[model samples]
Target: MDIKNLSLNPNYNILVTGGAGFIGSNLCEAILKNGNSVRCLDNYATGKPENIAPLLENPSFEFIEGDIRNAEDCLKACKGMDYVLHQAALGSVPRSINDPFTSNEVNVSGFLNMLIAARDAGVKRFVYAASSSTYGDSKNMPKVEDIIGKPLSPYAITKYVNELYADVFAKTYGMETIGLRYFNVFGRKQDPNGAYAAVIPKFVMHLMKHESPTINGDGSFSRDFTYIDNVIEMNVRSITGKNPDAVNTVYNVAYGERTSLNELVELLKEYLGEYDSKISNVEIVYGPERKGDVPHSLASIDKAKSLLGYSPSYDIKRGLKQAVDWYWKNLQ
Candidate 1:
């Protein structure tokens, strides 16, 4: 389905927490592109102002530099907002493993702050970024939303807690909440310099620099890498769709396909090499499996299709090509 076909209330004012991060910034851009007013709240802890630098020029987009953990900030951001897209959180399994407390503070306590603030502000809907990591330790392929395994890391626990809270809020306060369990999302503007940088951008950066990319495991572990445009579509559908059954439900945002790490490296090398032939020779180095990481992840998009009419626009190979092109143009 085309995103422009989705009927949204033009007068609605939206609040996007963590609106300066990769996914959040993209959501902000999409919201503004649809002719809606937006209020963005970000602490800039991991989110950079440069990500939203272009949006600042638009009078419809207003940004408040604030932390989600602060109740006052969340309340202020949520005021007069019709929809709340809470994307602010500390991600990465290794980072959570190193300091679970900080992850809990940002992901758990901060999430609660946003929920309460949004509910109190009388917002129409609350949508937050839930992780595919919430399906931890489950050996199931194409994981469905109803079934999930025990959380393996602090990050997983934090995201799973979001679903739990969303459910309770729906039942108790009559507030509607939707959780989008995003699988390995990658695209332009995804940070490549950080220690906690995601695999796609990190590999793209290495391949561009003619450096060997490291595979975390024996290169067999796989993931259902999702593109940012598909994610943005899901957000738009969740907020604008008229289905009552779709509200307060969690859907897996993915391409319903999996690619191994080794295959992924080859794809990146092939794409980036188009810009520089030498990058084709960039070798891959295998390392030990990361701690607190799941062996595999693949999402079932059937639920999203049946409920939210989520038709992903791009698959892995197509998405990687677009992402590589963007990084090559912008990062170079």
Candidate 2:
């Protein structure tokens, strides 16, 4: 991240909620590298400890072991911060389908708690993680933020509710808020061990072990697979952007292209094969389509580009190679 190019000040203080997770930890790492003061708040329920372990020794980094469900913890984390990056949420559509109560508690209620805390702390801007699932059941190929359809799952509902709350806070309280609706973000440190782990990492892990990965549908389901660096850039741009119109609105953060499940698996095998030639022969299995999943997800990133100056540096192939290399070196 070039601080000069982004027009960011090196001395500013930033707070990252869920800073021990894949996306949050990366944000903390980048901010610290940019010479900014960073405070992280996470309970480690879904977040990994090793993700933030190396950052613990940084002089400019602080971590608070706390959950967003606790209002006091949220207040404590938001104090003395110039900006708040809210990435704390119970993710996964299947998990939410099995248990809606826990999802609502952490995603909706906890999100509200963070908002109130940041408002009280007088944070200059609040940038949060939204989701493309909000466009659930919409027939649109390239998703635009304003043309959202009814949510398909409990988790999607919660994320949509977040956008509502953010708009309310911005309009009613005069707060500066920007919501980024990320589309299938993937990269290093993304956990592949869990049952609800995302497809990319899970498939990578399976391929590395020479095991077949199951595709929920007929391998036609596609996603706008975004890279982590692109996501980090969007967050940083959201916090530093000065456009008045840009605030109080949401933008889709994506690479503007879609990759089908078949294509994705082939790409994974092709890349991982470079490291272990046997990986190229791994077979992909097909299964029933999962509930509450969309057939295709592609985003129109023109809004983010025009408003936040977000130019994604890595495409799917480039980013996947980077991710495959990391998994090979670390997980293998």
Candidate 3:
């Protein structure tokens, strides 16, 4: 079966939880671009309709204003869908630290609700957004899927629980599930305004406004910083790749290269400076490290490549350039 056709079939309707969010919107667009039908379910708590505004005109796309925290919403969203991309969650360490209970309700309980609903709906595959934070405190340079460490934050605990629950569902319910453990994803449509905004977008936004961006702890902390396109490719592969050996496994979705904050800032300045010279001199302010923050994260994509034919198309520099260009044109 053609992968694109599989995603679009009326019989294979896809439900993308949090489909209005940055990553989810990108995934939705990709699915639609491939002639697939997609129903986006989002509560708009952290997602913006503007992110998906362009797709509203597409006949293949449907939007449902809903929350994953509600079992009824999940059940309603899962009805007759062939695949479920569970991307909805309360992300960010600080956010979860400040509101652990809300995070648990949305991330843990919400995830379980989706899993059960998808199983009951008899969806062909249940693919959820797992996280690189699951590798917390492992001290491993390139984290592998089989090895993990203690979760550092409530958010981490919730994501780690997704994998655990998925494993259980596969054994108990005989469901086919895959978890994509994303590493520091950044790209177009990423929200840059929130206090909990991710590093790349936040820095890009600050530089665009000619403001200094804060660098938590030292600038030496590094990340894998996988681009959105790479993530989309992984999602499509995970959903359609028919290899029985690759089913029901977790794979790291990343570029497999580490870029430090210092280098990242320099690169961003270089890229954004081409559009405005004033941004080049924007200095970074160092501050106390935030709680539950990891010093470095790099993923081993060997498993994804060998098993799923996964190949990342963008490195940090190229990805940041694309992201910065988008922010400059759209945000400004």
Provide the RMSD of all predictions against the true structure, rounded to 1 decimal: 1.1, 0.8, 2.1
Between 1 and 2, whose lDDT is larger? 2
Question: Residue 22 of model 1: what lDDT?
Answer: 94
**Model 3, position 258: C-alpha lDDT score:** 97
Ranking, lDDT, top scorer first: 2, 1, 3
Tens digit of per-residue lDDT, candidate 3, span 1-332:
12353343434578899999999999988887777789999999999989899999998899999888889999999998889988998899999999999999999999999999999999999999999999989987789999999999999999999999999999999999999999999999999888899999999888889999999998999999999999998888888778898979899999999999999999999999999999999889999999999999999999999888887889998898898888888988
- Full ranking by TM-score: 2, 1, 3
Better of 2 and 3 by TM-score: 2
lDDT of each: 0.92, 0.94, 0.90
Which candidate number has the best lDDT?
Answer: 2
Give RMSD (Å) of candidate 2 vs. truth.
0.8
Candidate 3 lowest-lDDT run of ten: 1-10
- Of 1 and 3, the candidate ranking higher by lDDT: 1
The sequence of per-residue lDDT tens digits that candidate 1 reaches over residues 1-332 is 23567776777899999899999999888888878999999999999989999999999999999998889999999999999988999999999999999999999999999999999999999999999999998887779898999999999999999899999999999999999999999998899988899999998888888888889989999999999999999998899878899998899999999999999999988888889999999889999999998888999999999988988988999999999999999998
Tens-digit lDDT track of model 2 for 1-332? 45456767889999999999999999999999899999999999999999999999999999999999999999999999999999999999999999999999999999999999999999999999999999999998799888989899999999999999999999899999999999999999999988899999999999999999999989999999999999999998998898888898999999999999999999999999999999999999999999999999999999999988999998999999999999989997
